[model samples]
Target: MYEMNVEDRGKLTSNRTFLVKNITKTMNVVDKLMEDGTITDDLKQDIEAKLTDNDKNRKLLDIIPRRGPKAFKAFLNALVKTDNAFSAEQLSPGAGAIYKVSMTSSEKGMVSPEEEKPQNQHSEIILPKKWPTEQDFVKDFIVKTCSHSEKGKLQSDNYYKMRSKPRGRVLMFNNFVAVAHKVEEEDGLWKEKLQMRDGTEKDEQSLRRLFEQLHFDVEVKKDRKVEQMRSDIAEEKAHRFHKDADCFILVFLSHGSTEGIYGTDGNVLTTDEVKSSLNNKNFGSMTNKPKLIFIQACCADTYDKGANVADNMAKDMSDARKSMSALNLNDPKLENVDEADSKVEKSPSDADMFIANATTQDNVSFRNTKFGSWFIQALVYIFRNYACQTDLLDMLTLVNKLVSEGRASDRDRNIAVAVSVFESTLRHKLHFFP
Candidate 1:
């Protein structure tokens, strides 16, 4: 095995104080170090537990020298990749100079000697070019799709009025950690534990930014129990802001079952309760206005083994026929047009509500610890790019397309895919006109 270089050790030791103070993205660096196999999960937890960035950095520095031979190099690379290049420079000036020169050359489209060298293509599976992060992908997608100038005017008759100063009030409930509890069954009391969601904060941040840009007043409630969530919803419903708002949006990011979303306390909050609480009868001010609910949670405990497009067409058609038959359109009750017209006169409490779940019924949603849920990522990206022009249903369709096309892997290396599902009772097209 290669030995740790004394020179690299010296660089880290010499600039320990400077690195501790200057490294801002310590978790990112920790993630990179862990990915490189330079640091173990235990060491990563130790670094993350330090409470402050400086403390985290100090913990990281303390661990690096004791790690394997490649640790120092990996740490430096981590710093550079995580936007702490200046700290990397302080640790090793020569490495910093090389990185800067490489970056500058890249910006100017001049390939370095190292990059010009041919690689053994047979040794690796070359993936298609992709953005380094979901954010970068979204930014690039938006720039390519949206024109800087406004393209068309929206007639009020065709679209919902979305011109209120603060177009809507958005309430987001993000539950990262589920509270462990015990279930008393016929056998005995069994402990139930849920894994903490790692990348949900990224989803929350993306959504907050997007909605704020869309001119909505946003409120985020983190790790709330069911009753607390209900209370917050009640308060939101009673808030006078709805008088001036054109729409309402509720977002839930949590672990869930087909029954409903889970609170931190492990208690379930059924989607029906959520809708009933905010229905037009309960929240009269929003009558006829759009009420959009976006849920990023697993609806069930199953994975989707996606089918080949060509082979699945016949099966899809058969399923469609079954579904249509189940609808019983031929029933004599369905032939009463006058009855339907009379029913339409009494507006349903759930009218104008749009509910979009991350995955279809009986399928688990996919979440990336590094990025976020595939559904929310695509939703934010598509909405940010197309909301200025596209209607809500069309935008959600794009979200469904983008998310379903994404692939995720489980611990067993099983490839899984997800498809977003939405149910809309929207009476008119809704556009943010951002």
Candidate 2:
């Protein structure tokens, strides 16, 4: 039922609010299903009237029960994707309530059944023996039905007969790296007009290229709010990708605090939120894969003095917008590249996960308005020259060495990087060799 109309949109603070709470106690979408398993006439009318490319939407009786209410919610979200990606078209799950090949569509966003792509025999997803909720299945349905090259009937399976070869994907969610200041007046008029993060553009650009060179399918997003960030790390797209990829690399470059990173809105988003988004328990297929979260933000509010003690560090989690110059590696002496071609046996159990922070909990780091932040530059340098030769930790060690030791032309501050190796499953060294 349309418990809350468009005019009531502002009062909504949660999905619960959207589905319940009319003074009349009238059944809302939240209580969409009555005891008899029938839906409100209002909702049924809404679904039926919404036609997709001249194809009538399937009857409501056919869409709901097969996947349950959560699948219906998934269908709601799918509609939004369709509206955004195509010209406001829609489709149903199918007439028979089957999970796959149920909907038929000619629109850019809706999938047709005959065109459905079969999943690879090796395709995988991490899940508990019993699902906690129907919503989770909805998310999985969306991911399983999509592919890299196409939308709607997108192929979830990408065959890889040679699973022994090193395989992985790098996902980049670096947004609002360069956000202008926003101000709301007493009258509530909002204004924005200034670039705050001068060097982050360079940081994102460099990382994207570096990962692509390493054969990682690089995906990037910029200037997202808190919900967008949360949806990203915890959603179907990212989770599904982990099923086949051997390693998952996340590079986040934005204003952050000791507690968590900041969304474009400047609110704190905790690191735990990030860890849960890619949790192994939730992602069974990724239990044995190496999950690396590379954070180029500050974990402390204090600054380090030149006395060379790490007790005091430098750099605000805020944007380091001093200079946009090219990266400069002091290049004292290069490490020997003898171990670049080595490989170790892969682990198939739940392990091999860690997080890399640019600074510890009490110190600050430095960034140049011209050359991006110090940590990101060091990361690019180490990966470009050493990933093929060194293991992941060793390369990160080099990253720590360079960032903590180098002096910036714009700011003369040095800080140590932090790494939390939550899991030690990498029995052998990692190589980005072809």
Candidate 3:
């Protein structure tokens, strides 16, 4: 039936330009599919129902740029809206159904085929009171994904329960390794400056308070060399190795770079080197456990307010893909070169590591004399309020919300947190016991 419809449609359109336009229109639907992350059996069926022929399908497939926020959104939209309203098999035991009413300007008509008429009986459509900015878009996207997930509540619970790990211990490392030295090496030059700014203490104090609230064993190390700090971490890891630890938390309050951390002696050591040293055979005894590392430091120098788009990494990937395409490279070479360029670290220390940088990739990690880094302050603040009762991501989302919608310098203090749990598949209620 699809083939016959395509054949008839093709006969009616002899104009190549019109055929090309038709093909482009069809491809737009495919692009939507790729955007929304919904490439499934039902997705294919819905798409097939929209297009009439193989030629149109081929044309549509060619226009998709491989990756983008739009494409990803389209992919996901296809997944939930196609077939039986929502995929029943994809829902978890306790999951409820999601029915989203996406509205378009009737005055302008629908922009895409995936956009269906709003089922709301009201004739006049009321636009959303506020247009969603990038941050709003990200939070909404995450919320939608979670709502659709099978183990949604449990996953959410595990994130919220930061201090409830029965098998793993939570260790909080507070205290910025102060930086004190007189310009490299000056013969007996003692510059006793307050290296860890007042801001640093606020973050440290808050972290300490959070743990104190949770009744977890907290360790505070101030004014330590690289080796000494590493040794302390090692000892703690070893102590917790045989003992039942629920989780391991390491918060570094100091000056940092993309490579590693800065010590009080003005010496820099790679975070990777420090973390690697804490592996199972080394200082880290809690192998395959959830390890969280929050680094309140700088990553890049570009702090353009306008550049705060959806996903910087995804944008970079898209740019790289375009660059590769423009180079006119062959299939094999493209695959190899692209693969090498896009390579990422698989695992960090066999422990679930969460690295939350103080700022975004190209933004500055702010420092206030009283509040510390905006990212850290926001993190601790949100965790203090919600960590025990809500999901970790939810808490982080709140942090993001607070930061994004906050003041001038503070707003720019964008944070980027990445986490990897060691697959325990368990949930806990994270709360301050005290």
Candidate 4:
């Protein structure tokens, strides 16, 4: 019946104005999809590769009267209006339906074979106030998916019950390791004094390769200033596709002070700024998802010169991640002041996010000019080797071990790097795909 209708429609004249209207509406749909991150950059590039074939297919498909893009728009419009427990053809008979709606628009002059001047019902048409954002879509999905899923038992009495795993994205980007060394004064008059970082390229390469293997869409930004860094990170969090990711990773590599990390221009940007930029509340779709941030830089310039140092070999804290649970803030305790501090970490008590600092507050984290930052080296190694078998916190602790005692026998200079969880909803153990 569908084919016969198509055959009959093929006999009709292809009206130029009607084709333009349909194409215009279709473009609107595609633009909205791209904004929602349903059609990603990578997905767009893939489709563009076969542009000629795609265009031809699009033109041919558009030949079918009252179908294609117009039909899709009408379907979404119906979803917006009704609260019906929607279902489509079962994906494979017994398998559950993948909520699809196939309906034709009631717009007049739909280039039909009948040549009937159909009465218009354009006045009754109701469009959505705003297109559903990707985050909006997923939160809705989570509510629906969880409603249908088999409920699982909670892990511990202290741990809150989670019927559904919080959804999120694995967002990774380098704020661009900037030049931190001092340059000679304008006309070579005064010698500028400073510490320097080298071989960060090693860190970048290792990260790009590692995430590629792990199947994350990674983007690297270099030479980002303070305001610029803040904007970009915020934009990423606000991106339409961000809500779909279950995990987020932010790796910071630059010179930092006891207060916070610095941008390429040597201006300090507080971790509080970072917190705001990456706040989970900003993304309704990612409210309970895990956001992992790894920062590697000197917390300060106070390098120890071996005076009041201990007379023993530095002990690598091999059991760091095990003790990590004793950190971070979030959904469980943030809003409830009475249970705060005691139930979770202090201050910025958001949820489902981890902040890893290379050095503790008010201390310097040593870096090697020859290899790379000690912290990043250990992080890449542990992630590449241990992520499959180890829990995330444990993996970070293992990284702390290698970085703290694992540095050259130069001096007992700095303390261990730390990873803090903020608003953590990590109710269960997670592992990277082997």
| Top-lDDT structure, candidate number | 1
| lDDT per model vs. reference | 0.68, 0.46, 0.41, 0.44
Residue-level lDDT of model 1, residues 68-156, one tens digit each, is 68888787777666656546755764444354443443232322232222221111212112212343332111111223343243446
- Give lDDT for model 2: 0.46
- Deviation from native of the Cα of residue 148 in model 1, angstroms: 9.8
Report clash pairs, candidate 1: none
- TM-scores, in order shown? 0.62, 0.48, 0.45, 0.49
RMSD of each: 13.8, 18.4, 24.5, 19.1
- Comparing 2 with 4 on TM-score, the higher-scoring candidate is 4
lDDT of 3: 0.41
Q: Which numbered prediction scores highest in TM-score against the true structure?
A: 1
Return the TM-score for candidate 3, rounded to 2 decimals: 0.45
lDDT score for residue 58 of model 1 = 86
Candidate 4 residue lDDT tens string, 162-200: 223323334443444453434577787644333334656
Writing each residue's lDDT as its tens digit, candidate 3 over 344-399 gives 74333333444455555434444555444456656654554333344554556556
User: Which window of 10 residues has the lowest lDDT sum in candidate 4?
Assistant: 139-148
Clashes of 2: 24
Give candidate 4 regions above 4 Å deviation.
1-196, 304-349, 409-425
Superposed model 2: Cα runs more than 4 Å off: 1-166, 177-195, 236-239, 306-350, 408-428
